[model samples]
Each structure stands twice: as C-alpha cells, then as structure tokens.
Target: MPQANWFPRFRLFLLGVLCVVPSSSLFAQEQPGQFVLTPGVVVDRSANRIFVVEPSDALATVALQSNTGEVLWKNESATRPLSISAGHSLMSLGSVDANRLGVLVLDGDTGKVRAESPLNIPPEAATLAAPLGEGRLDATAVIRGQRGLLRWNYTPPVTKQGLPPGTLSGLPNAELIPEVAQPQPALNDNPGGFVEIDLETGEQSVVDPAAAPNFAPANDAPEQPLLPEIPGPKYLSADGRHVMARERTKGESHRFMMLVFDKQSGEAIGKFPSNVSYVPFYVDEGRIVLQKEEFAEAIDGQLVKQPRQLQALDLNSGEVIWRQPIAEMKFRGPPPP
Candidate 1:
C-alpha cells in the first residue's frame, strides 16, 4: 500500500521548511518532516456552504455562512474544481484575454463572482502551472455540452536541478505521476496535457499525455462534477442526499484526529482536527462540514503542520458548529473560488 511512487513530497513544518530523510532512503523509516495535504475542506451541501481552501502559498479561501457559519467570502479563484456543469460551479485556470489560455467558470454560489467562463488554451503552449513551490492536483470529466478532459499537473522545477521540490519524481503521478526524468531546464516550461474543455461553448483543445480520455465513464456518474485525484474516504453531498466519510481519528497516527462519517449510517458525524480538501458537506439533515489542519509543535525534530480552521458539525449534536480561521497563504492568485 506504499506506492504512490512511494509518496514523499514533504512540506509543512509550519513553513519552517526542512525535509531530510536520507538514511539511504526507502522512506528511511518515514518522516521527512511530513505534513503537506491541502485541498482543505469543501462542503457545499447544495448551498449549506463551508469551503476553506487554504493552500498556504496561494489559495486562501473561506466562504462560510450558510446556517450562521459566518464569514461569507474572503477570496476566490479556485484551483481546479471542474465538474458542476451547466451551472458550472468551480473550474479554475482562467484567462481568455491577456494572452489566450482559459477556464474560469465559477459560480461560487452567491458568495459573489457569479460566472467566469474562459479557457481557450493556446498562447504558445507550455505553462500548465503548480510548479515553483506547490499546490496542484486536478482531474476532470466535466460535461454539459460535449468534450471534456483537463489533466493539468505541473510539479517540475527542482530549483533548476538543485533539487528540493518534492524531489523524487518518476511521475506516473504515482506511476502516472512517477515518470521522473526531465529536470534539466524546466522541460518545455513544465507541461502535462489533456485540456479539452468545451463543456458548452467555453471551447479549448489540447490532448497529448498519450491521448488521455475515457474519463472513467464520465467520472463515475452520480451526477458528474468529476474531481478525483484523491477526494474522500467517501464524501458526496451537493444534492446526492448525503455521504461523508474521511475517517482517521487515529490509525496512521502522526498526530491525527479527524473524523466525519455517515457514509450511509456508519455514524460519527463530524469532529475536525484537519486533513480533507475536497467535499465533506451534508448540511440540511442537520449539518456537518469539515476542514481544519493544525499539528503545531515539533519543529526541528519534525511534526509541523498548518492550516488553522473552518469547522461545522452537528449531525445530531456532534457539536462544533462554527470555527473559521486560516491565514498564511502566499504566491498570490486570488479572485475566484
């Protein structure tokens, strides 16, 4: 179970930034200052609201206020959420002006910025994004009109070969993200293909990554919003009725304590400590939303995690109804979420 290319793209020492682990490697008994997981909670429960993106280098989102979660709107410019079609709710990667390259489609549900639409791709290619610090992981199946692909994952710029940017890429993206080779000059400015968007007139095209398309039968239809790079121990709300699960109250412990299950009666409604980045919202049958990250302590000896809060629970008194608080995100890129 240890083969996401052997996972070790370490980051999160509370931004003290330090990762060693080289006893000869093989995970060297794990712990390269671990703790780097951000998608940071996203539970829109058909407008019950509670999104807290917080990528801390750029992403800083927060749109609470649905049943008094308070604080509706901070900054929005979503980073690849694609698949809330027709009414298109989150699809990032914008700009159909300033030089072509598009994809903005944001509705963000009355938190402001209603509709963006832009992603025409083609301004000399090469510049997919998410490289030069970190914060990226996209996978789409978008459908409303016709063709839809979107695979964009940058991650390549080992400081111009000085290493220290997740360092150990063979990129198959975990085999597909595990093809590590090109580290000699940004390799065509860091690219990875398949951005076929046309989910109805937004139009754009580009494919190579070996022709990529099959979209797993349209991202396993359950009413497609197609987003899976790793989204859940089981979440599904936004009108699918209810289905949250992100368990780990202690099992792979590294200072973990996170729960949110009700995967159809497994119980354990909500209890956030943090670690869940996309979808975990039920709101309505009584409430439940998740996203919080705070490991705080152990700096040099290692155990650094950060991403303050954004909580909501009460699926029948699970308690912790409102928490919101996440600050410290740089690299600038705010305008849609």
Candidate 2:
C-alpha cells in the first residue's frame, strides 16, 4: 500500500539525449526507464513478492516482506497490462503496432528479459502468459478471432512453426500441443472441447463436452464476453481450471464487477456484490475472498472515517465466513485480505 509518489523518479536532466531536442517536442518528459503514470489494474503475486503494474504504464515490482518498492521495469507508451504476472517468472505484453505486438519474458530470480517475441500467436489479445508447474513448462495464449487456444511448449530444443515463427512444433517425441478450442465467451461458459496429448503416441482427443456425461455446461444465464475495463492479474486456481477477475466500467462512476470462471467447464461460479480487487480464489478448496464497503455521515460533522471491509466467502455453501473492518491499517489504500 505504498503511495505512488514514494517510488523513485528518473531525472531527465541527467541524460544528455534531451539536450538536442526542442522544447515544443516535449509533450511529456520521459523518465529514464518509465512509462506515463496511470493507476494500476493488474497485480501478480508469487512466493513473498507482489508486482503491481500501474495504469500509467509503469512497472513496480515490490518486495512484500520489506514493504519496499522499486522500479524493476517500465514502458514508454500507454499500455494495457501496466504490470503482468511476476512469480517464479514474469511475463509482459505490449503493442508494437495495430497488427504487430511484442512479449517480454523476464527471469523471476533476476529482473531480466529472457526472451522477446513479436505478435506471432493468433490475433487474440492476451497479456503476460507463462507456463506454471514443473517439467516442460509451456506458455498458453488465447487466440482471438479463431475462437481457439494456442500453446507453445518452451522446454528447450525449441522448434519453429510457420505462423508463430519461433514456436517449436512437429517434434518426434516431445510434449507438444498445437491448438485448443477457445472457451465460449459467456459467463461461466464450460469448456466445450478437450484435447488429450499422449507423450508416447502423440495422440489427441477433441472430445466434445456435450457427449460427455461427466461434464456440464457452465452457467444457466446467457454468455457475456469480458468487458473492456477488467483489472487483470487474473488468478488461476492451482489446477489452472478457474479464473478470478474484476470487470470494470469506465467513466466517473468506475463501476467494477467481480467474475469467477471455470476454464475446464466454462462456468460462471458467482458474481459478488460491490467492487473488490485483492481477492483470493481457490475453487478446489471451496474458498474465495470478498469485500464490502459503505459510507455514512460522521458523528462529528466530518466525513465517515470507515467504509471498507473484507470477508471470506464459501462458493459452494454461498455463505460468509468472517468480516473485518479495514480501518486500523497504516496504509492509505484498501487493506489486503
């Protein structure tokens, strides 16, 4: 909960690059390695640290233990994912042009770019994506127009593909996955198809959910595509079957909508009341974190000092486990759950 101003600021005067430039060209003075300031929407946490990407397109990789903030990275243009996922590794995505795009993969141990690639994966708009777990960690990216999913296995001896240039493909006996159906763009939309890749035979199954009795459609309501202004750092459960996200409405009101989806079944679990950001969603454990707030007139003629609180929610039972006021914290923003 550190103030935005508390972080480091790069002084442009130190760089002689601006000396030859005229004053009129200066719409905004650039920091040595920073982007224009904006409120952050995506937050990624791994181990003990949290990385917050500001809306201003600046990157702040913070050490949660020390409560100390540092400019681990930055961007020059106004971008979408101010901060992407920073865990055992960090993934960052940005636009290079209308059709062209780029991705920056950073080593989690040391904030350094391990790879940079152009927008080769289909047209789907995806943020930072990294493979989780051990053994042949792969990168999965959503393919926009094709209504499909694209994954690249990057466990070395990288292969080259026609479209996604650097993507390894058609290996003799490697764990490679070519494509998958894009999950329906509706709330709680269940995964309609399945792909089973065998390590020995390299066989795949495009099983339709409709044919399988074990599977069920996601939600009872109509499908809704994710809104334009959703906060990222989308949380995937330990199995990567569920995703927790915040959908926002732009403008003065800044309304926010909380959504939980099961990627396996393509189902909408539940939408909570009020806007909440720091929620922890674990589907298998039947646990979710939520928050609520209210404003009232103060007893003294001053504004009410407290309006925010947090709670633990049980998704299956649909009940509240606990509630606590967020007033005692020394920070200025919402307290962590």
Candidate 3:
C-alpha cells in the first residue's frame, strides 16, 4: 500500500513541476526592462515619467526610466524652453509676446512629441499643472488662468473651457469636456483624464473646477470668499480625490491632515491627521503610506540619518494600519556604537 501511494505522490509532484516549468520559462523569457518607473511618481501609474520646469526659466527636463531604474530618454530644449506638468506632456510659452501657452504632448513610451496646441492664456501665467489621460500625446491641459482655470483638450483641437469660481481651482475647464459629465470615467491616461465625484449626477467622471465654464454672458455665480477656518491645502491627490495638508495650531506642533475630498464636486469628504512633517505619502488603493524619517544619534559627528518606518494609513477608516520598519541591514554601519 505504501509503494502504491508513492507512485501517486510521484505523479502529483510531476504535475506540479510541469505547471512550474511553464511559469518559470515565461518569467525567464520576459525582458526585465519592459516595466518602466518602478513605484512610479504620482499614485497614477499613467504618469510614470516626470519633467521639471527649471527655476532658471530656461529649459525643462524629462525624467524617463524603465521600471528597472534604467534611464530610457530625456528631452532638453534651450530655444523654446518647456514646463511639463506631471507626465510626458509639457507647456511652453512660445514667446513673451505670445498670449498663449503651447501645450506639447509627448509619447510616454517613446518620448516623442506628437501634437501641440496653443492654450489661450497670458504669457505671465505662474505655473502649469499636468494630468494623465488617454494616450501619451492625447492629454488634457489644466491651465492656471488669472481669473480662474482653463482646460484644453489637446487631441480634439484644443477645446477650451473656463471655470469662474465655486468650481475646482486647478482643474477649471474640466466641465467643458463631455466625458466628465458621463457616469463612467472619460479621460484615462491622457494628461488630464481623471474622474471626480459628480455630486449632481452622483457618479464619477472627470474632475470639475470650482466653477463651470461661462461660455456666454450668462449670470455667473457670485465668487465665494476663502474660508476663514478652512485649513490650508498643501498637497493634491494624483487621482484628485484627496489633499494632504497641514494646519498651524495655536501652541501645538503643526497639525497634518489627510483631507479626503470629492474630486468632481471639490467638496470636503473628511480630513484625518497623519502627525508627521515633510514626509512622502502615497495613496495605495485607499491607504496612505507615509514614509517617515528616522534619526540615529550623532555618535561620530557624521550627518547620516536612517529611515526607520513606513507609516501606513487607512484613508477610508482613518486609522494607522501598521508601521513597517526599515531593516537595519539596509543601512551601513556607523563609525562606532
């Protein structure tokens, strides 16, 4: 009977090996360089790359890398200069006299410029914000306007919309896009394709600004004054659902809050304290991973601080789930004890 059971065990083991062999082969066959930008910037995987508008007001630089941390490509323009939002797309003011910002779209995979549109805005615009949706080239531009916000749909010939007031601040022209009105999400991976909670329809679609675009001379709503007690907004959620901010307390240390908001309506959902400073936080699924800093006592008078723990927060429940510690082995040994 034992010998008979051995044969059955051998058959089961052989079957397991056969299944493992294919998976191992597939894993070995796949190129390790296929994945790009590990962990990715912005919670939005779509905006895997990042570009910085240089402080010198000169040219902009793209930060492109494979998922394996390999530098894929970079673009630097000295003539026109560039200001990219968050992803492959960039904004370039053609000239000081030009009254518009040229929205330049680029392929995320290949870093190729595909299209350009002149966003109707004054050259003196302070900053440019980018969102991801659709393809690498096809994206929405959320232009920071003097009065309000201007949204431009780059693919469909730069459809313009303006948000006066009471709409979302940064994403002013979001309402002009029809996809934002729909129940399902419209803008996918394009520059500005994120759905917000549409309060009127009670559905998720593209995020709307504080006020809808006043295309005609209609009775624009009164501008709402800034709230006195409202805490200052410090961070914008990549998906446009929440804002991580800090409020100064009378005598206490700085109060940190993870402000959950309705992306569509720009209404406050809830705010929870994270109780940390200058820490990098990420919204994974619905949880917030606050990468906290840890310090080791200055023993040999060297400036080497070690990271200690990752504070994880449950955004929905507003609770600290766990504090994952950084393994001591990850850090080099100090000069002495």
Q: Which candidate leads the pack in TM-score? A: 3
Worst 10 residues of 2 by lDDT: 11-20
Model 1: how far residue 157 lies from native, Å? 2.1
Name the better of 2 and 3 by TM-score. Answer: 3
Candidate 2 on 33-126: residue-level lDDT in tens? 1211111222233332233333222323321111222334444321222222213333333333423334444444455554444434321111
lDDT of 1 at 86: 29
The local distance difference test score of each candidate is 0.41, 0.33, 0.33
Report the lDDT of model 1 for residue 110: 51
RMSD of each: 20.5, 22.8, 25.9
Candidate 1, 56-168: lDDT as tens digits: 64433455665777766655445323333324254444323433334555455653434344543222222322222332323333333344455544333232234466555
Q: What is the TM-score of each candidate against the true structure?
A: 0.26, 0.27, 0.28
Root mean square deviation (Cα) for candidate 1: 20.5
